[model samples]
Target: MARIVVIGSGMGAMASAARLAVAGHRVAVYERAATYGGALGRFERDGFVFDTGPGLLHLPAVYRDLFVKTGKEPLERCVALTPVDPASRHLFDDGTDVSLPNASRAQVVSALDAALGVGAGERWGDFLNRARDAWDRTRRPLLEEPLRPDWQVLGRDPYPSVRRRRVLRRDQWAATVGEIGAWELADPRLAALLESYALAYGLDPRSAPAAAAVLPYMEQTFGSWYVRGGMRELARALYERCLARKVEFAFGAEVVAVTEKDGRAAGVELSDGTVVEADSVVFGADPRALAGMTSGRQAWAPGDVEPGPVPPGRFTVFLALRGGRPDGTVHRTVVHSPDAGAEASAAFRGEHSGRPTITVLRPDDPVTRPDDAHEAVTLTATVAAHGPVDWTDEALVARYADGMAAAALPAVPDLRERLLWREVRTPADTAAATGAAGGAVPPPALAGAEGRHLHTANTTRLPGLLLAGGWAHPGGGLAHAGMSGALVAGLVVEGDGFRGSQ
Candidate 1:
């Protein structure tokens, strides 16, 4: 059995450690922080709790597969996963409101038709069917496997974009998310709904490839899930699974540099001046830190996918309200901005948009509140990743959070009066917690725009070193991060010929 050293204790790292251990390798995970989970953080006060990371889980089969591969107990036995009904409530600026049922195409169609117009449902249904075609085309290459050497082939757009006739008698093709929305959806509300997914995932709809439609298709088709306590529970379950698989963890052990012997990875040098030897190194931290550790050693040769620019982080406000959660309240509510395109433009430009696209989450879980008489609510918005705006500036963060809460008024009509206390977090906190450059959250890989949307492969030019995390192959989002681990393990255990899971 080879001795493997895994960096960071985030879900992706832990998932790799568990799988490698089960494969009979001796694995040790060294984390810079005192705890694991990375972005899957939590906030609490007076028995009120809020998930600081992703509020819901889409494509949960990633974790389910992880649990099954690593341990005797299944994922269901480790954590309570419940389907979130009325998957999401969209509150458009035009006073158009609709709640889509979880993974029920007919129900989603009916709801949209009733709220937007008679033809709206059919339009959206047709769009989703097209989105499904994209998903089927890219799912295996993008999610179920490691980034291939001939990844440029993925540069081809797989969305089967609709073609239209232009005034000049030329064929107009939809390439970006915005073009797809404008040309196909043909409804401002439908366009906003589609663009919201792009913004939430740190992509501007104007530039994000039409393949991005796969995002909504994945969510509406697979359905959204919630853990009993919070998303933190999913992390805890994965960590515990790692321990059960005999993967050792060294918390607060920051790796300073990667040691090399005869131009191959020999071990890792810790911040405390300790050198730990290993046969292979699995880095689950940010690519920035990896570069620092590699010294002059290049991780990628020419033509390899370059790590894209750091993405914008999220701005969150956790509210402890006195009023109980009202009945018939949907778990997730998205309040669209008056001009979503403008908001997205401002965000990408690192400027503040007067109107913000707000996502309000109020899970119907008891542990989040002190009692049934109280409620815990979370409001979040996409903002410039910490750099352009000083997220460390307290006054600035509070001011932005104030706007987010105000924007959320549509979701919580009595937000001001019901609020008892509030907590705000910026990308600065994310930077402190996970050491990501600019506190940026990585975006998932998309199959278009000349492969500008793909992430660096797991296998680096530096032998014996691989990547598995948000910044790695398959890219970000809770589910994709887990897939990175699976890919890393498959590469290590099965050698270079490993394609992916069957």
Candidate 2:
């Protein structure tokens, strides 16, 4: 059995460690922070708890596969997931509102027809059908495949023509969504919805590949979900599984470098000068951070690495309120400006406009939140990282906080007065804490026709070195990260090289 050292105890790291350990490998996970979950963790302040990252849960099958593969069932450990109807509530500046329900296509079309107009329903139906096709075509070849050289897949020449042909086919299929906004949908609202889906990947729909259209299908079909407790419970469940599998975890141990000898990974050196040697190393952190660790390595060069365009960063305001919950009881809300395109353009141009794309999540789900006396609400707004707000200046930070509050909680005029607690996080803080460059860690931009490739790492780049995080191919999000981990495990097992250690 090979000794494996995994850097960063994020969901990706933990999931991979669990799988490797279950396969009988001696797996050790090293995390920089004190906690096990990186972004999937929670912080409590003044009787209020906040998930530091990732609020919604989508694609339950990803986690299910991880648990089942590691010899545990997720449902047995975590609370049962309930479907969220009206998956999200969209509020527009012109007093217009749209609710996307978790329902049949006909139902969704009817709802759109009622909200947007007569022809809109038909247009939405067509759009969703196209998205479904994209999902089916790309899920296996692009997402599930390990993007690496494998002796099993490559029996003779590692760079075989057949493998190249498969890669090309996957790339061609992934590029289809680039026309969604410009050609696919004529209605501005429909186009906006399509664009919004792309924004989840921190990509602009106009430039995003067709593979992205798959998101709507997955969301509408599988349905968005929320854990019985907060999303952090999912991380806790994984942590529990890792323990059961006897995976060794070293929290608060930051890795400084990946040591190499004879052009192969030897192990890692920690920030405190501790050297831990292993047969293989799995880096489950941001690819940029991992690249930084190889400062003078010849196998990889810094200039060869090309990070994706940093998506617009976010400004968040957390409020602890003492008021009766809204009657409708919406779990997620997306408040859009009437001129969303203009607002997005302004933000992209590094302008701080009063209007922002706002999203709010209330901690009122009966399963997650007990009928307590207090309630919590999280308000988020997308802001340009290069905006006028001075991140280092404390006064500017407070001013920006007030600006976000005014824009987001205007309907609830007494929002500030009812607050039992308040906190703010800027892009700078998110970048530093999460290890994502510019606080917006998105995948490399979809490759162009000329194939202008980005040097960002893929899910699998080398033998025994697998990536299982937001940085991996098939890219970001809680569910995708977990799937990346499991996919890598499957690759290793299929190679017949994985053997568990006692």
Candidate 3:
């Protein structure tokens, strides 16, 4: 049995530690922060609570598989998950409103048709049909399996674009999500709706590949879920699972350097110069930082997926309201921007824009409120990271937060009247919390656009060092992180021959 040292306590690293422990490898985790979860966090005030990270879970099977492999207790027994019915409510700028049901394609299609027009649902349904085709084509190589060295084929677009003729342009297939919306969907409202999916993941639809359809396809097909107590509870469950597997943890122990004696990774050197040796090392952080520690040894090769442009981050406003959550309310609502194109461009370009798109989450679970009389509302938007914007400017933050909150007033009619207090979390907070350089949130790896959407492979050029996290293979998102951990553990236990989870 080899001794494995997992760097960072992000969900991916923790998941790997648990699996490695179950495999009989002595696993130890070192987290720089006092807490285990990376982006998953919580804020509480006056008995009201809010999740600071992802509001919902997509593809829960990832965690379920982790629990089944690591312990006898199933994931359902560990964390109480509630399906978000009417998956989401879309508040378009044109006063068009819609409530899409959870995991029910028929219901969602019907709702879209009823609200938008008779043919709107059919167009959306057809788009999803094509999206599903893309999902099936790339799901394995892009997700379930470990990223391959010669992954050039994955760069070919899996989304079969419908050919359309544009004015003063030759007939062509829609290459990007923006084109798909414009040329195919043909309605500005529908275009905004399509772009919202990409924006939610910090992606720009205009540049994001048509294969990006997989994002919405995965969510709508599998479902959106919420933990009863907040996403933090899910993190707590995984941390506990790791502990149960006898994995040791060291908090406030920052790994300054990765020590190397031979050609392979030897161990990790802590901030205080304490070196802990291990046979294998799992790094759950930016590959650049890992390189800095290993004498500038890079993780990716020439053809491998290298780090692309710096990513955009999330801006969130948490409201502790005086009134209770309304009855029969959709758990998630997206208040669409007045100009989706402008918003997408600004976010991707790392520029500030007024009236950015916002996602409002209001979970009716009593656990989030002080009592039945009070409620908690979280409003979030995709925006430029802390560096581009003046995050330290108090007035700027308040202005942005106010605009986002006001956008949700229609969804929560009594938002202003039911007011208590609101706290804002900028990318600055994300940078401080997750240690991302600019508080940027990496979007999930997508197939197409010349492999530009892919992330660094889990297997590094270094023999014993591996990568796992939102920044690694399969890329960012709760489920992808879990998959990263599984892949890492498989590579560690089964050696270089390991393919992936199954």
Instruction: Give the TM-scores of the predictions, in the order they appear.
Output: 0.99, 0.85, 0.98
Instruction: List candidate 3 stretches off by more than 4 Å.
Output: 166-169
Q: After superposing candidate 1, which stretches have Cα over 4 Å from the reference?
A: none
- Give per-residue CA lDDT, model 1, range 63-138, as digits (tens): 9899998888999999999999999999998898999999999999999999998999999999999999999999
Q: List candidate 2 stretches off by more than 4 Å.
A: 148-179, 298-306, 346-353, 366-371, 386-390, 410-417, 443-463, 494-502
Model 2, residue 403: distance off in Å is 3.3
Order the candidates by TM-score, highest first — what do you get?
1, 3, 2
lDDT of each: 0.91, 0.65, 0.90
Tens digit of per-residue lDDT, candidate 2, span 104-203: 6778888888888898888778767766665665465345654433212211111101111243465212343435544555666776676666665555
Worst 10 residues of 2 by lDDT: 155-164
lDDT of 3 by residue, 342-385 (tens): 88888877787788888989998889999999989899999998
lDDT of 3: 0.90
Higher-ranked by lDDT: 1 or 3:
1
Whole-model lDDT, candidate 1?
A: 0.91
